[model samples]
Target: MSEATEVKKVGQTPVSNSEAVKVANTSGTTPVDTSKSTDKKKKKKKKRTNISKIENYFPDGVYPEGEWMNYDQDFNLARTTDEEKRYLTRDLENQDHWNEVRKAAEIHRRVRKNVEGKIHPGMRLTEIADLIENTTRKYTDAEDLTKMDDPTSRGIGFPTGLSINDIAAHFTPNKGDKTILRYEDVMKVDFGVQVNGNIIDSAWTVSFDPQYDNLLTAVREATNTGIKEAGIDVRLTDIGEAIQEVMESYEVEINGDTYGVKPCRNLCGHNIGPWRIHGGKSVPIVKNGDITKMEEGEHFAIETFGSTGSGYVTTEGECSHYAVQDYDYDAPSLPSANKLLETINKSFGTLPFCRRYLDKIGEDEHEYALNYLVKQGYVQDYPPLVDIPGSYTAQYEHTILLHPNKKEIVSRGDDY
Candidate 1:
């Protein structure tokens, strides 16, 4: 029979008597035909496409969605009344709040994973920043938040920090940065993603040379230690002490020189509020006398930096990170500065942004205006936080949500 005829007759054709008897006699049992059953099974199977797989990440059936990260609950943190528990549960279960946070975390996790092992020795710092930011925009569907259906729904939480070597944090490339990565350099990749002002601030370190492996490991373990020790009503000092103990225990040897890792005392991770990266509380890396306790329903970025040089960071180099101040301030007298201020207020609000972002959005000749705003205390400028020259530094960070019932590491991933 022809191929088309045979395929058409698959489930409709009946077996001949001779064939049935032959099969029954050979097997010593009755033969059961399965063509119709097999055809039914095949018809029932749904064809999976790449679009379908992508759609699975979006729980709300929206485009450009992210998968939810795994979470666990800690019931032993603090005691709550039944009524309070119900209230807390309602907050935790609110899809509008927790789901947005999870989506942002997943976008961060995926963007970090996508850029891993892609940073080579000769790539420019600008290229690296673009790669990270573009990938984040693609995942969040906020390439141009102004044009989106909901302008403030999803976007970058802060400027992409590509701080290399002793440069610890708050560093990103300007419009024409020519800095190149070196094989011996230890680079810290710090970035954030935000959905409805809930930011997932996380970071990891990369090194091409094996000599700096311990540096990365030390900082990563320190951050993890802080995450583990954090809970409701846990004192920030205790968490810092734990982080310091774990960070200082390791020593790195480069070219027959042994150096102990020290936590960056000045660069403590801060709490994250709605549209606020530095919310009131600061989680120190070293034991300070700050007895502030982690409260319920608070979001914090537990970041740790370990350096071979001074465990302190000073603001140096040209400033790239800028954010509008929360309080009221006088508007600039210059028309250009006033226009730029309006743009900043409308585009970024309190979320941290970089100069390159302004350029991308077609804001030209904004240098003077931006500086004037910074000078007038209407906007805050964050220069590169550097440890010391000729030293190596590494950082690791994770954003956690302190629920009334459990502590959820929103940015937790397998890579770090």
Candidate 2:
């Protein structure tokens, strides 16, 4: 209903000419002292680069500059909203429930990780994807819920996000679609859910392109770099620039041509609070100076969506439903709220949710509870909006907390 919003940025303003010039001078390359020995000059230049100064990009402090997120209160409001919507939707006809959704998500993760880890090589994108989908049948209820002729109820698995090389992201398999995985393919898999009244959405990518390993590596490293640099005092834009700088340093080579990997300007990691998908304050992973800092108690998905084309990206001119955000709070509750909440509480609690629980909500208020659960961080899902063009892109996401002890990664499913 929000008009299928594209990736948006905030906390940015026009820079004065003087300011731009000063910033440019500081970031510009240093003059080479060719008169000195080549080896000595290289060492001297390295010392001058002063990687240590990178830490100065943030404000002096350990905590964020704003009020910390009240997860309990905020999530409760979000859950209530989600439940109201679920009450109006049709119920999933399949019996696999949330288990099936979880199975699919995990299976995809395994296959993607396997590819990233070199467990399988020369596998095409679709081959790897098929293996993941078929593997889910081994554990999930093997019913096609989205089929019209089938008597099975329409389930939440009707949609999925599959992004392959040059394709930023957001693709689903129709009744009989097939796409194969190929060597040097960078693959990204993102998914969502509607269990009970909760939702969970996430994504990650793998690269098989040999020439662009360093580019992929740089982007991967940037995820960690941005996370480490994130804090109460760090500007969000700084995170973007840092990632941009790292990726730019590496020449992105694909199909025998050298290119540059740009941070998908339109896509960045966002706040992950209860059912209000795309929470607040987009933390840019590519930027031009303006910044936003992380605060304690604020749960965020420090996701990295990178590309091998120009940093600027335009949408595909078409929009698809990925995850529905719950915004209605004053709506009346349906009979299924109680049952849905109960199921959600039992299955999800404070942990992330999956789509299988939608069936338990009794079809009436399933979507309503779905929104509520997402607010509770139960039914979490990643929005499918990435830059286009090029053959490959990579994504690495992790849910984290800005705590006093340290920045804690809540989703410990993967390292990157």
Candidate 3:
């Protein structure tokens, strides 16, 4: 989760420094006369559009009084052209849906920017998780989980994943866990934000040492390659081949040993649906024979992982990520398990949750109930997806919305 210095509007040019100064002067401060300024040549400022004012899109702020719908007439009017409007109204069928998706993506971008450069070697993993989750709660206005039953409730889509070193994904700090980041560790920060179940899943790798720069670059470029290759009717296999070509081409050397970056063959990005993180289709990192074509009006998380060891991951360590199974099944016999299931349905629905979230909502001493639900096939437990032990891994991900007219990289930022 990296970010740019200033937030830019979608399909709009960035505000220049002079325009920024003009904005800063509106706060009851005397404006500086640019006529007396040093520069001889004056550049004309581009006309600002309503779309550039992100605040207009969220007129009532991040939290709405009722449903999280944008009632602003300018919301639809802000489109750059009539074709863009048709893409939203006719093709997508709902302008507010895409608006919510963009809002959720913006929340992710802002939170990631706030937390960047704050993670250091000595911070506890729990501290880092809390920092990220709390910031997300503040931005989404869903701080109170007990009151998250609103139709357009906005909050974390899943637990904050702080997977480190060989662990590629699905690892979060459980309650009382005391793991600390070290100077040489390569940590992957993965998180999601959801507005009315439109989840924006994005991630990036961080390392204090410079030796892993190539590793980070390979995975990041691979992710961007996938994004660039993805389109309305693009075959999934071609995108994977393009990703692998960029990712596997780079090699990293550490301690007099060179390791060719390998795409994690077992892990692949997937399509995302409402309240569903992994929606049916898989976007592979390496070239495969799967002939899935990315459809218009579909959302996807195009993530890539580069590993120094085997280009595969296995489930290991403590399980923290959990989601209610989508299939229908018989209810558990245990009353506690039934209660836990009820809670999960009420608070998270089909979205993922962690043990730490359960504790946050005052579910104390409920391990047995949680385990019972999992054993009864009422829930799915996701353990840490790790590569070979002692081998380093890096990951980069971005969420894409495939519109009929154009593909929007919703989770994109300056710092990939």
Tens-digit lDDT track of model 1 for 53-127: 222577664422232222222545234556557756566466567767877887787787778778888889999
How does each model score on lDDT? 0.82, 0.50, 0.84
Candidate no. 1 TM-score: 0.81
Tens digit of per-residue lDDT, candidate 3, span 1-416: 22228766889977666786788799888988664452555555675522222344478755221112121223333434765666555654755777788888887887888787889888899999998888788778778888655623678989998999999999999999989898889999999999889999999998988999999999999998888788766789989999999999999997679999999999999999898999999999999988888886898999999999898999999899999996676777899899888888888889999999999988977799999888878899999999998899999999987765566787877677
TM-score-better candidate, 1 vs 3:
1
Among all windows of 10 consecutive residues in model 2, the one with the lowest summed lDDT is 49-58
Clash counts for the predictions, in order: 0, 63, 0
* TM-score to native of every candidate shown: 0.81, 0.51, 0.80
Once superposed on the true structure, which residue ranges of model 1 sit more than 4 Å away at CA? 1-56, 59-88
Off by over 4 Å in 3: 1-57, 60-89
- Model 2 Cα lDDT, one tens digit per residue, 319-387: 323243334443324445445655544333433323432332234336566555456543445434545
Q: Which ten residues in a row have the lowest lDDT in candidate 3?
A: 63-72
Better of 2 and 3 by TM-score: 3
TM-score of 3: 0.80
By TM-score rank, best first, the candidates go 1, 3, 2
